[model samples]
Target chain A: MRLVLLIFSFCDWLQRTPVASYMRASFWAFPLVESLHILCGNVPLLVATSILSARLAGWGLREVPVSKLARGLLPWAWTGFLIQVITGLLLFSSAAAKYASTRIFPLKMLLILLAGTNALIFMRTTYRRVAAWDTAEVPPLGARFAGVVSLLLWSSVLVMGRVLNSAVSLVVAAHLWFAR
Target chain B: MPDFLSWCQWLESTPMSATLRDSLWLFPAIETVHLFGIVALVGSTSILDLRLMGFTLAGTPVPKLARRVLPWAWLGFGIQAATGFFLFAAEASRVYLNPAFRFKMLMLVAAGLNALLFHVMTSRSAAQWEGRSTTPMSAKIAGLSSLALWFAIVIAGRMIAYFE
Candidate 1:
């Protein structure tokens, strides 16, 4: 109710900003930013996270200590995450209201939130005990569980993000069919 | 060129292409899979590239890392090729004419050649430098060029949509 209204108003305000206007007006800005988002942002973050998660699950790289793998990969993951945040904000600003209204966009955001939460919980809990099983062929149950959930949630986020564009077309087609 | 264009036209007319183009869900589904393939392909390759450049994972032997990581890269490549072929089939003629698509194909070839040349020339001496902190100059060159080409391929692939 009030929260939804606040969100919509915020989106409207965002869409009216100069950054949004510039994003819309410049022919190359949107696409170029999107390319950067996909290449440097989403890909690296997903890859680094996936590798870490896979190791946590005792899937591969069993020889490398979990702490060492995390040390090496977390920087890449953070860099990618930073790029994603900047580019995502730029993209959202371009059509904030429309994106806010889209079902897929909200869903994508929710999944990302969940993924982040999963990572945090894992870090605070099982990951704190990583030294006990850092090089184990099979990690503890908590670590493996966290790894699997993280993988699924992040993959869903990716799917939802990619489907955002096509989902709009599907909605339009449904609307047209109903109108006819 | 004319023959290639005709072949593209023929591909566009095929029933499979028509089905993919007409269906809203199928194309997006395949495209999502294609994105996953890119993640796996580029992700695994980048790990190895960073290692070869002595930037990260310096302690791991080159052969050991390659043996572990290259399988995933090959798997990703298989997924990319299969999905990419279907995607190309869906809009063969238009994509054939697309400059971005053409550039992406060129980069893919270049990336492939770089990998092959590295395997043939640089990696042949893996016995000599497998555990060294710094890789040979040729390996570093191959790694850097590969990273550049793949990133270029990703950009070009994204541009195909905007160009269209």
Candidate 2:
């Protein structure tokens, strides 16, 4: 498709950038940036969002109002997400074409998009009525559904991210095995 | 040190460890569980830490919040310990040689000790200040230290592969 070609061209451009070249050239840069990505972005984002989801599902933290928990925690979730976007982009730029071609990368991105859409729909619908059962031990069915779905989606995204890393190693291992 | 090295070697030869190392799917599967375990563990701990620091959910008493969150943290801890042992067993000899792995172990001990100390010292007096929006200075210090140590642990854990 023309769109796919366009996207690949964009990836090619990104991969050719000076920053991308530096990321590939430097030994410490990739790992250090990756450590930062996991620590700052993935960890906090998953934690905050998981806690929020848990609360929505009536799994824990029953005393705190949902709104209060969301208010306190959503900021952290957003902050983590912001960091994820920045770090993810930086990492992607280094091997844009390869990442674009990878199945796992697209899968991870799709999971993220679905997670975001789930949150958006929840906020627009069930969450609009949060006041009704904000402190209830069991939130409405819709909120709980959203919560469970979000948890599974986000966790899958995490797994896929890890899988993406391992997939590369697997390829290298296969190459080595062939070489041997 | 020699005794430890031999122990690691023995672990590496065990049937369980051999299975984990040989299987393509098993290692990644367990590692994925380990990742989720971290979410539960660090996620619960951070919630409590944030509350203790008067950052969030101040309206809820500390004891009440602890009652709600600590179980999940313990569950997460149990998962981590179990999965971590398997992971260590799979590559015990090599991991023992890894500086990052060694550092992670030290950080884990320190983090555990920090938590134990908080429970013994600061948390005993939690009842007195549980209602206040601002926690005692000691509690804040404990929370801050736990957060820092856990983040360090995660970073160190990630660096294990890089080091190897």
The two-chain DockQ for each candidate, comma-separated, is 0.71, 0.58
Cα lDDT tens digits, model 2, B14-96, are 99999999998888888888888887788789878888777877777888878888998999999999999998999999999
lDDT per residue as tens, model 2, A1-180:
999999999999999999999998987777777877777787789988888898888898787789988998788899989998998888888878877787899899999999999999999999998889988988899999999999999989989987887876677577789999
lDDT of each: 0.88, 0.87
Model 2 residue A111 lDDT score? 96
Among the numbered candidates, top TM-score falls to: 1
Clashing pairs in 1: none
lDDT of 2: 0.87
TM-score of 1: 0.93
As a whole number from 0 to 100, the lDDT of residue B18 in candidate 1 is: 98
lDDT tens digits by residue: candidate 1, B33-59: 999998899988988898888888777
Give the local distance difference test score of model 1.
0.88
